[model samples]
Target: MLPVDAMITNQEKLNSLATECAFHRFSIAEIQAATRNFHNDLVIGKGGFGKVYKGRINGTRDTTRRIVAIKRLDSFSMQGAAEFMTEIEMLTKVRHSNLVSLIGYYFDDNEMILVYEYITNGTIEHHLRKADAPLSWMHRLKISIGAAEGLNYLHTGVGNQQGVVHRDVKSSNILLDENWVAKIADFGLSKFIDQQTSGVSTRLKGTFGYLDPEYYMTGRLTRKSDVYSFGVVLFELLTGRRAVDTSFREEEWNLAKWAEKCVKERRLDQIIDSHIKAQISPKCLKEFVQIATRCLKSCRKKRPTMAGVVLALQQSMALQEQYDSSPQSASFTHIVQHLFSGSRLNSVVSTSASAPVTPIPHRFSSPPVTPSPHRFSMSPKLDKIDPVHLTLNLVARATQNFSPSLKLGEGGFGTVYKAELPEGQLFAVKRAKKEHFEALRSEFRSEVKLLAKIDHRNLMKLLGSIDNGNEHLIITEYVPNGTLRGHLDGAHGSVLDFCQRLEICIDIAHGLTYLHIYAEKKIIHGDIKSSNILLTERFRAKVSDFGFARLGDAETDGAQVVNKVRGTLGYLDPEYMRTHQLTPKIDVYSFGVLLIEILTGRRPIQSKRSPDEKVTLRWAFGKYIEGDIMDLVDPQMKESLDIEIIEKIFELAFQCAAPTRADRPDMKVVGEQLWAIRMDYIRNGRRG
Candidate 1:
């Protein structure tokens, strides 16, 4: 029996799962009738979780009855309420063709039961071990692809929620339907990954032979742990052998270790299942073995993601199909060479299953080649715009060989150059430094991937990019008016009035709102200083430089641990620096400092000022609390400021710069309050 505290925790989790899952609830009598009073003759499957009985029940929203699998928990079962509620929660939220569907559940009178859509065929382990029929190579390939897709969906996640790790992935969890389509079942030991956490530490929970060695030894579980277990299942499908057999010698008992040894010694032919050996193509076998071995790598990080596994399996199937359609005398090498000669295989090989998958950026002509017009199209979000790629030579010519005279300013990772193309169109080209090439290249790739997906008026538009041998460039639409910092420091010839400053702040707020909530994925701008903000000829603000941007936290706690801190010093959130816990509120804190900078026309920090006024936010906040908010306004602004509106703005700034993220307002609320303040300022005819 679970401890009192453990049972209470399980009950809380069950209550939360119940809210998201809206399946039918059966009474004890109905469940008993469906399972024929728990008769042994009706039992179709048995596990640590107890017996799964084949039963018939009326369909959901239909009069006709349908076959269902009713899982009844035994009184002395190893699994308890935790596993029961986890399955209900996961199945209700995720719906995929390759995953089994949950029909309903019953938890009355201490008799816990889960009803699932009945699969015509039994588990993969049953076919491999018990059935007289042998699985053909093609059938095995199809099953592998289907099962891989299901696991990929679980790891990649459903919508915005964190992904799930199937801690118990094995042959028994994969089922087949009438058409032989595979369906992954049994979420009894699954765990949801925190969005920002690389792995979770938990008590060991999985079958012995299929468990990841790293996870078993260290108890640190990750999606890669599931990848390792699925690799064992792949070997099982390939060799027609159980994962563990104590009858075999000590070393030979473990299939993963033995198969890895066979692969290392170049003796793969000795381990191929006799039933499918003759039907397997050499090319297909090679690809399958490559992916399977990668999945079983000792280091968890070296294991391929489930999506990568699915791709490799699909490629193997395609190779087998191609071989079947061709003559026996056709050279496998020739076919592979032909496929690799095309762009599809070239691109696919670049994003290998063993490496992290990233969107392939469009490469363009450098020197010594005639440049052609390449359509730089992005997906889903940027589908509405048609962008043209720029050649490196053309960019070089426009910027006068990256002349210092054409230099705009320097950014976090590179130098910004102003350019005017032959057609008279203006642009800003960022050229990365040669020193620290690896880090800069990573930042370059990160910025490109992030900029490609986002398309907003207040967000800087990514025009094109160049990645020649030693040169890396990012080209964006040039804002002729320079940066917000330049204008605030009078480098733009005149200081911005209060009304214009309010509009600029509002624009920044709108852009942040879109990034945090409206985008396909929530993004946090790690560095949100005033210098990173740009202005058009009309002084409209656009947030730029996504080098420090990251996907926001998906954990319920609203904060994620970080290994390294990145941001401007003065505008940095003190809490983030102190604790190394990142949240969207860090950006709000920076924005608060920017707000003070806008009102006062000062940098975040000024060592030249007196000790009491050195740091702008600290000094302004102190004055604000003392009811001297009017003194914080920019003395250069000639217009008379409204005292009521000034007090409200200062109050909001303090709220945004709260000591802790929990006390700060989300961007949605902050934007709304800013809009209200602007309206009030205008209502009193206080527009500068």
Candidate 2:
């Protein structure tokens, strides 16, 4: 017999081994009884590897239900004792927040039984398939971030041993927990590579849709190969479509090919899930397309690293913040006018009471307000009614009691309320707070005068305003969907598809263009951030909140004045903050920061592990430029994003966030590039 201590140590090792192998030492009779002799009713799910069954594990005094996904190793199958050993070793050492935990197992005679934690929320593939309960863009982003973070840990986690790579990383392999958090599963095809042999070649192993094409052709596996597979997952997440659909026959069976074709023909809209269409911002859609295209590129070297992918998603969220802070540009002004040109604005203005005249000297005889021809219809009599009274009662009834439920949201200015008219029209009523009544008065007058003169789709419309006693309210068309910040914070859904994110950036740029150039008085949006940009049901963006907006003039204070710094923390322009010099480029710099957020999925001020680690995106851009783009993306998004689009977005963000404002592209150029990219997808039949 052995010494007592040695004997105990050996027993402990045995127990550990048993746990790793999932061996419970269940008697044949007990298993059969629990499973009801493997009855069909007990069957839960089936996969290529094995069948799953729901059963009960019983003790002398109690019984508890347990779900076990059983994978029986055929005696004669190619995957024998060696593969089993490899799997046991891997599963034993790997544990993470987003990795499925292993449970007990059994081994007797020629049979082998393995158990795992039961994930009740089902598989990622299930959510992608369900039509009625579709996953929102925000949820998708969150999932992508979590999954990617887990994979990142696995790929470069701590150990004396080599890094491990999960050869299979499709949607089916991603399991969802109770809260819908994604946990990567199915590591049967995993391989461990010592850093010393980092460049070694191996046999290609993975499902077709998610396999890295380079690994298949060259037989060389690198971390970048995982990046390629992740791109496919991103495409699936964005489109809510499958990787491989046999129903499409020989030509359209391939998802990549089909998507590429659609992109080329500007018909990508046809390929996306209808449920996701209304929920995703056009900016996000454009970014998704760009990212997906890059991920599927023929060359693997051009792909973004997993870190880069994460950064891209974070960057998308940042862009929303920037948009909220900035004022509407000229292009947006044009679009808004065009959208309501035919009737709405004209009907309101033309039917209003005649303008009150003020005597002026002959030298200054010009009219105070010159209504555009597009502002009203040709009908002379229709313009006779007073427009002010037409909307006064509507505003009064909407703000009745100022019910809490109908209150839309609150901001620096005051609370907003949602009002419904007898005609079923919805409007957003922004009520000024008592403390800020004076500022509110100024803003109300400024907005009324300015909006009345300018028209654009990207600019928020001023439907009307009310100044009654101490209560002041500004009414505008109601946007059902909330602010961009809501979506970024995971309120709306997971990650915004890359394409849609890009489109949102472009939309903001267009609005900025209109304000900077097209408007009668060139104006500057003082603050640009996600919370201030509003979205519509169709995911179209409209720049809102112009209370801090100012016009450029010779008598204006110095561009770099010593004044209080006002704007969101992460998106503030470094130059503006330090020197207090404000310029149109200040908005550009903020937009650049937003671009970085879109690319990295990281906040501008994320804390690093060490006190010295730089968390700002500006400091982190170098890592991405060095081909570590994957490090920047939200881990939840790593599994499903396209590497190419990530890289492209990174490039754009880099340009936008350049240290010097002079190096950045103007909003018009940025808008044009985004529009061109969207058009490219449209022309290629990639977007429907």
Candidate 3:
């Protein structure tokens, strides 16, 4: 029996956990009501630790009832209180569609219970073993991909939290929903891993058949162990047999070992489940078998990480989909003929291919008689090929012969001019400078290509372009309120409120998040600074300047070697500058500088300031450490500031600008954090 003090400490920890997680805490009365006084009829499933009861619980905010699975602890269960608490802690911190969600919990009157979003269907184990019909090839692929994604999310940190290793991974724990969507459940044996830590030291704890061979030999548990177990599950899916079946021959008892041997012998077809044997595409099966076998390698180092497993699984799925979508020779010939039709080519070419824009009739019959301060020497080849081809004469006339008064701003690419057509339609035209025309032509085309694929409210919109042999110009929607730098400098003749600044920061975060993760192709917005962010009349931010952007994958090592670093000096990532490695984190680091600038109303660098305050990040960080960061807040906005919001923003800024890429959170997390801060500010400010 534990001492009184030990019992009190455990209770205190539980109280803290209840407060930290956002899950609803249920009263014992509510639990009994939901489960009908623990009726035997409601018991849907039973396990070593508890019986899962399908229960109806009315939501706190609404009258609508929610069906949930309530797992109640048994008196003689194998799992004790510690395992229960661990499961609660793990589920609350990480959230992803592929992972089971914890709805609420009850731990009153010596009764420990967990409530989960009820999966309509049952466990993958059930379908694999006792179901009336075998899972189809497509269904199996979808389930495996979803399960792999959930494991990947656990192995790699989600949002602001560090990664959690789901120590117990098997087909039994992978639950399927009504739509056949896979959700990884059973986090009782999970462990959280910090960024610097490779693995944790712990006593061996896993099912016999699904245990990692290396982990079994050595008690040290790592993410690779989870991968090994997931590999065993894959083989179970592959062979439609239990992980360890004594009825099978001795060599075939262990699924992982048997599968590995079959793969090595190139005789995997012998064990392929007859149901999916003919359905599986040769290429997909080959890739699937290779990745699964690699996961079962005895050496932990040789085992693929969960993330690698996910990528491989996704690739295999894609291959299978392509095979499914392939047409016969006769159908393929017809498809080619249909694709070459003139109307289809014209409509699809604008977005999918580079088709020269059909030139519109010029609003003005002739060019302006007077040459403005900004002059564009006309190119000889005016109608040269490119997407969104605007006639040179129409653009030149719209901008009043590139008038100095109409010019909005200038960057490495060229000067931007606000153009107004006769119909009063406004557009921002970016005309390449004469001296750098030849050098920047390709860059101009790349930017056009990148912008064509982009479609986000927070990102600048691409209207059209003009590319003659000598002159190159890109057009976009005109943002009337001007750049963020202008507002920060008070060029707008109004001081921005604290709330407005916070909104602007959130908008920028949204834009960056989309660029880094949600775009059709992942992009690194190589340059991010106050000047690059343009504001709409309502103070909404639209991130512009894709001249230096690069197309890259965000999921791999996330680093690419660059011949030369390109970005505004003060906002450039220090690590990128020092090592010449480019990644999405550079934009994150730049955004950190922008955040500090927004709060302090100071430029990233102030040469005239004293040595201590010359660099805003350095000085702001020092003040942050001293708990006097409020001293640096913009004086005009200080009156409406919430201390908590200020601290959180500054804290996030510093985290983004941390010395190494590993220390920085991804843009998606940063966006979520900013939104949370905004909500907190709105709530707390009202209270004040």
- lDDT for each candidate structure: 0.77, 0.62, 0.76
Question: Which pairs clash inside model 1?
Answer: none
Which residue runs of candidate 3 sit more than 4 Å off their true CA positions? 1-6, 76-79, 159-161, 326-688
Best by lDDT: 1
The model with the greatest TM-score is: 3
Cα error, candidate 1, residue 449 (Å)? 29
Q: What clash count does candidate 1 reach?
A: 0
lDDT of 1 by residue, 540-636 (tens): 9999988878777666434678777777756667667656777888899889888888989888767678866767766775455333557889888
Instruction: Please identify which of the two predictions, 1 or 2, would achieve the higher TM-score against the true structure.
Output: 1
Q: Over the stretch 1-688, how does candidate 2's per-residue lDDT look in tens digits?
A: 3345544554465478766654454565665666687677877666555666666655323476565554444442345444544565677778898898765555443554555666777777888996348787767866876777677667756365467778788888887888888899877778887633434587777899788787888898876677777777877887777889887677777777778788889997887877667666565565556656666766777666554555555444333323334232211112223323453321101100012222211111232222211121112231222234324444546555466667666665667778776666566877777665774566556655665555677777766665655456666667888877666555777556656676777888889888777788777776666667888887778888776566655355214353555555556555555456666766776677766665555555544434222344544554553456567675644345545455656656655654445546677777765665565455555543
How many pairs of residues collide in each model? 0, 134, 0
RMSD to native, candidate 3: 17.8
Across 217-310, the per-residue lDDT of candidate 3 in tens digits comes to 8788888889889988888888898888989889888887788788778897887998889999886787788778777878776565665566
